[model samples]
Target: MSSTQHTDTLKNVRTISTLLYWVCAIAIIFQILVVPLVWYAPGWVEASTSQMTVSLADLHALSGWQKYVTMAVMMIPSLVLAYGLYRLRKMFGAFAHNAIFQPEPIRHLKAFGIALLAQTLIKPLTGAATSVLATFHRPAGERVLSIGLSNAEASTLFLGGLIIVIAWVLGEAARIDDENRSFV
Candidate 1:
């Protein structure tokens, strides 16, 4: 291909990639904010809908403004990070196809595995933390960190969080390998 054609192709790829990166980032951000709020909302608003008791005592305390701020803070970055990592994978894939060191994809894959394993560790820890929080809650509604949520609920949240992070890390690792392979 002509040099100009190659340059145009690269630019097109970059544009497409950047758009996808932002989309993923936005999703992650939405998850971050929405998950926690939604998680906590069960007992207050939606419990009847579920035909069960679901306490979101933890989130009940946040004022309207605080909720918005907290939601943005938590969700936006979560999305950015996840989306960035996912984008990395795609970018690397392209690099692998074009570059010399195709073997790098293996490295990325391994790193993804490691990330997944590492991410798995967080839920249990979060659970432990939640359990600890629960003990101190004493039905007092005092502490913000009170492990008020049932073990099952907390575990689910923890697990979901872990999965998100692990998925992101795995994506990043995979991309790394892609880039590596591209160099060869």
Candidate 2:
């Protein structure tokens, strides 16, 4: 592509990077506030107490420690997502600087992909952990444990795989570009 194309592409990437930066910042802040929100404003959460159906009120009604445990359970995936978003923001930043073929963006892409895959793998664990934690104070007969798979998890894994493949392709392209330069 020509220099003008590079400049235009970089400009678009910069715009997208700016948007992603704000989104990640806001998401991080929201994730951090989840505990406080759950503690102070339980209305924001929707959970039921039937073990099969738990509402935010059910979680809110738990003892303080139990609530904290539940919060921790919920925070794990959110934190991972935040970290992924942060990596993606960095990747976009590099792209904005016309660093598409450099190692930095490739590394960021790989990290983000791994992070997403990690989240996909841990989702069931988190759910089980949360269920166990939520029932920490419950009577023996009232306790419950559950785990399952969902389309969202499958989608996440697919996206992660796609990202890793894209990174690999880019890396190969960078190698080819270097080889072509040698011939010049």
Clashing residue pairs found in predicted model 2: 46-56, 47-54, 47-55, 47-56, 48-53, 48-54, 48-55
**How far off is residue 18 in model 1, in Å?**
8.8
Cα lDDT tens digits, model 2, 84-116, are: 877887887787666778988888898889889
In model 1, which regions exceed 4 Å deviation?
A: 1-27, 30-54, 58-105, 139-184
Query: Which portions of model 2 show Cα errors greater than 4 Å?
Result: 1-6, 47-53
Query: For residues 87-129, what per-residue lDDT tens digits would candidate 1 score against the true structure?
Result: 4465455453553233353344344344334433443444334
Local error of candidate 1 at 147, Å? 11
Question: Each prediction's TM-score against the native?
Answer: 0.37, 0.83
RMSD value for candidate 1: 9.6
Candidate 2 overall lDDT versus native? 0.75
Local error of candidate 2 at 136, Å?
2.4
